[model samples]
Target: MKIIILGAGQVGGTLAENLVGEKNEITVVDCDTSCLRELQDRFDLQVVEGYGSHPDVLEKAGAEDADMLIAVTSSDEINMTACQVAYSLFHTPTKIARIRSPNYLKYKEKLFQSQDVPVDYLIAPEQLVTNYIRRLVECPGALQVMEFADGKASLVAVKAYYGGSLVGHALSTLREHMPHIDTRVAAIFRRGRPIRPQGTTIIEADDEVFFIADTKHIRTVMSELQRLEKTYQKIIIVGGGNVGLGLAQALEKSHPSVKLIERNPQRAEYVASELAKATVFCGDASDQELLSEENVEQTDLFIAVTDDDEANIMSAMLAKRMGAAKVMVLIQRGAYVDLVQGGDIDIAISPQQATISSLLTHVRRGDIVNVYSLRRGAAEAIEAIAHGDSSTSKVVGRMISEIKLPPGTTIGAVVRGEEVLIAHDDTRIEQDDHVILFLVDKKYITDVERLFEPSPFFFF
Candidate 1:
C-alpha cells in the first residue's frame, strides 16, 4: 500500500519501522528535519519537511497517489485538518488520525464524516494505553492480556515462577491439574527465544508462557504458571500527562483509592479537579521523601507514566524497593524495553507497540478482525476469518495438522458461529470460522494470510 504518515514522532517512527518491513510504500511528513533525516537513514521511505497539515507538504509527500494518510501529529487540530485535506484535496481512501482529547472523540459520530472531519479511523493512543493498563490491573499477575472473539476467549502472557505448582512439569499436566476448563498452551519463550510447545515440553521458571482459554477460566489457567497476586486495591500513578490522567480516571470507579503525582503544580491541580475520586499531589515521583509520605509501601500497584523514561524507571524502582507489590513503567524506546522487562519493573509498557497494533490491523491485507503485537513486536496473535468451502479454500475442511502452517506459527483457537474451540491436531477448520493464530515471528504473517485465501475454484 502507498501510504503517507504525518508526524515523525514516536508513534509515526514505530509505524514506519513496522510497515516498511512488510513491503509498503511509506512517506513520512514532519517539520523536524533532523527527525526526518534520521528516519530516512534507517528505512526505505520518503520524508517531506513542512507542517504536516499543509496542502503543499501533503502534495509533496505524494498524497496524490497515496492509498492511505495517517495523521499522528501531536496537535489534534493538525491531525484532524490533515485528514480533511487528504480527503478533500487528494481523496485518499483511508484517513486515520490519532485523536487524544475526549471532547473531540465524544463527538466522533458527527465530527468524523466524509463531509466533516473526514477521518475514517480515529486512533486514540492515550485511550489505548489506558485500556491496556486497566486490563493489566484487572488481571493480577498477567504480563499481557489480550481479548479475542469479543471477550469470549483471551490470550494471556505470564512469567513462570518457582512457586507455581506446575513450574517444573510437562505441558500435559495442565489437564490433570484442572480437567474441566479447556485451555491451550499457545507458545513459550525463554531468554527472548521461541520454544515450540508440546505435551512433553517442560515449563521451567522464568519462562514467558502464552496461553489461550475461555475468558472466565483465565485466572485458573494463569495460576499454573505463577502464583496469582491479591487483587489490586490501592494504586499510585506518577505523571499527570494524558495517559496518567486518563488511567487514573478510568480506575477511579473500580478501585477504592487512587493517588496521582504530578511534578507540575498547575497540572496536578487540574488533574485533582477533573477526577472525583483520585487524589493528586504536586511533587517529584522519584523523591524518596514524597513517595514514603504518600505511603508507597502500602500501595498495591505503582505505575510511572511520566514523559521521561529515566524518571519513570527510577520512580518505579523506588516504589518496588520500598515495598510496592507490583510496579509498571512506560518506556517509549524499543532498546530500553528489553533492558527493563523481567527486571525490577513488573511490566514494561510500550506506547509505540500498543499503538502500532491497531494501526497495523488496518494495514493488513486479509480480512483480519484483530491483531495483538506481543513480545515487543517480535510475535503476533491474529484473528482472521476463513472464507470459501473445502473445494476453494486451503484451510476449510482441513485438519489442523494438515494445514501448511509457517515454521513458527500455531493455530491457537477457532471460533465458529457461537462456539469457541481450542485448536487440536485433529480439529478441522470450517468455512467462516475465525481462526486465531500465534506467530512467534511476524515475518510469516504473509504465509499465514495466504492459507486463508480463496482459490480459483471459488470464482467458478
Candidate 2:
C-alpha cells in the first residue's frame, strides 16, 4: 500500500516504523526539517518538507497515488484541512485524521462527512488514552484491559502472584477451580519471553498472563492467576492536560474521591470550573511536600500523565515510594516503558501505542472491527467479522480446531449477536460471528487476515 502521513510527530513516526516493516510505501510530510531527517534516518520512507495542509505539499508527497492519507499534525485544524485537501485534490480513497478537540467531535456528522471535510476516520489519541486508563481503573488488578466483540468479551493481562490458588499449577487447573466459568489462557510471558500456553503449562509467580473471557467473568478468571485487589478509590491524577482533564471528567461521575493536580494555575482553575465533583489543586506534581500534604500515602491509585516524560516518571516513582497502592505513568519512549514497567510502576501507558491501534483498525484488511497492540507491539489482538458460507470462507462453518490458524495465534472468543462464547475445539464459527484472536508473533498478521477473507473465486 502507498500511503502519505502528515506530521512526523510521535504517532506518525511510530506508524511509519510499523507500516514500513509490512512493506508499505510510506511518505511523511512535516514542517520540521529536523523531524523529517530523523524519520528518514530511522525508516525506509520518503519525507517531504512543507506544511501538511497545503495543496503543494500533498502533491510533493505523492498524495495523488497514495492509497491512504493520515493527518496527525499537532494542530487539529491542520489535520482536518489536510484530509480535506487530500480528498479534494488527490481523491485519496481513505482519509484518517487525529482530532483532539471534543468541541469538533460533538458535530462529527457536520465536520467529517465526505461532502465536507471528507475524513473517513477520526482518531482521538487523548480520548483513547483516557478510555484505556479508565478500563485499568475499573479492573484494578489488570495490567491491561481491552474489550472485544463489542463489550461482550474482553482480553485481560494480569500478573500471577505467589499466593494465588493456581499460580503454581498447570493451566488446566483453572477449569477445576471454576468449572462453571468459560475462559481461555491465551498467552503467558515469563521474564519477558513468550511461552506458548497449553493445558499442562504451569504458571509461575510473576508471570504475565493474558486471558479471554466474558466481560462479567473477567474478574473471576483473573482471581485464578492473581489475588484480586481491593476496588480502587481516592484516585489522584497528575497534570491537567488533555488526557488528565478528560480522565478527571470521566471519573467524576463514575468514581467519587477523585483529585486532579496541575502546576499551571490557569489550567487548574479551568479544570476546576468544568468538574462538578472532583477536587482540583494548583501545585507541582513533583513536589513531595504537596503530595504528602494531599495524603498521597493513602491514595489508592496515582496516575502521572504530564507531558514531560522525566516528570511523569519521577512523580510516579515518588508515588510508589510513598506507599500508593498502584502507580501508572504515561511515557512515550519504548525503552523507558520497558525499563520502568513491571518494576515499581504498575503500568506504563504509551500514547503512541494507543494511537497506533486506532490507526491500524483502518489500515488492516478484511472486515476487522478492532485492533489492539499488546506487549509493546510484539503481539496483537484483533476482532474480525466472519462472512460467507462453507465454500466461500475458510473460517465460517468450520469448527475452531479445523480452522488453519497460524502458529502462535489463538482464537480466544467469538461473539454472535448478543452472546459471547469462549472459543473451544468443538465450537463452530458461523457467518457474521465476531472472532477475537490473539497473535503472540505479529509477523503472522497477514496469514490471519487471509484466513478471514472470503475466497475470490466464489460469487455472491
Candidate 3:
C-alpha cells in the first residue's frame, strides 16, 4: 500500500516507525527540514520537505496514487486543510485528519460530510486518551481494559492485591475456584513482555495480570480475585490542561466530588468557569505542603494529567504516598512505561501512545474488526466477525475443538445476537456471530477474518 503522512511530529513519527516494518511504501511530508532528515535517516522511506497543506507539495509526495493520506500536524486547521487538499487533488481512497480541539470533535461528522472535506476519519488524541482513562475508572479493579468488537469481549488487566484469594495460588489451581467461569489467562506481562505461564505460575502480589474473557464474566473473574469494586466518589485532578479539564468535566457530570489543581491561575480560572462543580485550586500539584493543605489524602482517586511528565509522576507518587486509594498518571513518553512498572504509580496513560495504537489498528482493519495492543503490543486482543461463506462456517454449531483455529490465537468470547457467550470448547459459533480472539502475532488478522464474513457494523 502507498501511504502519505503529513507532519513528522511525535504521533506522525511514531506511526511512520510502526508502519515501516509492515512493508508499506510510506512517504512523510513536513515543513521542518530537521524532522524530515531524521525520518529519512531512521526509516526505510521517502521524506518530502514542504508545507503539507499545499496541493503542489502533496503532489510532489505522490498523493495522487497514494492508498491513504493522513494529516496530523500540530495545528488542527492545517491538518483539516491538508486532508481537504489531498482529497480534492489526489482523490485518495482513505483520508484521515487529526483534530485536537474538543469542540471540533463534537461536530466532526457534519464537518466532514456536509462540508465535503472528503475526510474518512478524524483522530482526536485528547478525546482518545480521556476515553481510555474513563474505561479504567469504570472498571476500577482492572489494571487495564481493552474492549473488542464494541464491547463483545474484553482483555482486562487485573492485579492480585494483598490477601486476595488468587494471590498465592498457581494459574492451574484457579479452576477449582472458577470451575464454571469461561476465561483464560492469555498472557502474563510480568516486567514488560508476555510471559508463558505454567500450571505452577503463582499469582504474586502486585502482579499486573492480563486475562482474556467474555464481557459478562469480567465481574465474575474480578469477584473471584477478591478485588472490591467501588464507585469513585471523590476525585482530585492535578492539571488544567486539555486532558485534565476534559476528564474533570466528564466526572463532574457524573456527580463525583471533583477538584482540579492547576499551577497557572488563569488556566485554573478557566477550568473553574467551565466546570462549576469542580473546585479549581491555583497551586503546584507537586508541592507536598499544598497537597496536604488541600487534603489530598482524603480523595478517593488522584489523577495527574499535567503536560509535564515529571510533574505528573511526582504528583501521582505524592498522592500514593499520602494515602490516596487510587493514583493514575498521564505520561506522554513511551519509554517511561518501564519506570511506571516499578510500582510507584498505579496506572500511567499515554495520549501519544494511545493515538498511535488507535491509528495503527484502523490502518490494519482490512480483516480485523477490533484490535487493542496489550502489554505494549506484545499480544493483541482482536475481535473478528465470522462470515457464512467462509470455510469455518461448516463448524458453526460444532464445538471449538472441532474447528481449526490458527496457531497462537484463542477464542475468548462469541457474541451471537444479544447474547455474550463465554467461550468454551463446546461453544459453537454462528454464521454472523462476532468472535473475539487473542493473538500473539498481528499478521494473523487476515486468517482470522477469513473465518467469518464481514459484518456491516464492524467498523465506524
Which predicted model would earn the best lDDT? 2
Which stretch of 10 consecutive residues in model 3 shows the poorest summed lDDT? 451-460
lDDT of each: 0.90, 0.91, 0.78
How well does each candidate superpose onto the true structure, as a TM-score? 0.94, 0.96, 0.88
Tens digits of lDDT, candidate 2, 1-460: 8999999988898888778877689999998999999999988999999999999989999988899999999999999999988888889999999999888988987878999888999999889999999999999899999998768899999999999999889988889999999999899999989999999999999999999999999888888888889888899999999899999999889876999999999999999998989999999888999999999999999999988999999998998899888999999887789888878988999989999998999998889989998877889999999998998999989999898899999999999999999899999999999999999988888888888889857532
Worst 10 residues of 1 by lDDT: 451-460
Tell me how far the alpha carbon of residue 148 in candidate 3 is from the true structure, in angstroms, after superposition.
Answer: 3.0
* Superior candidate under TM-score, 2 versus 3: 2
**Deviation of model 1 at 181, angstroms:** 1.4
Q: Which digits, one per residue and each the tens of the lDDT, describe model 1 over residues 224-253?
A: 789888889999999999899999989999
lDDT, model 1: 0.90
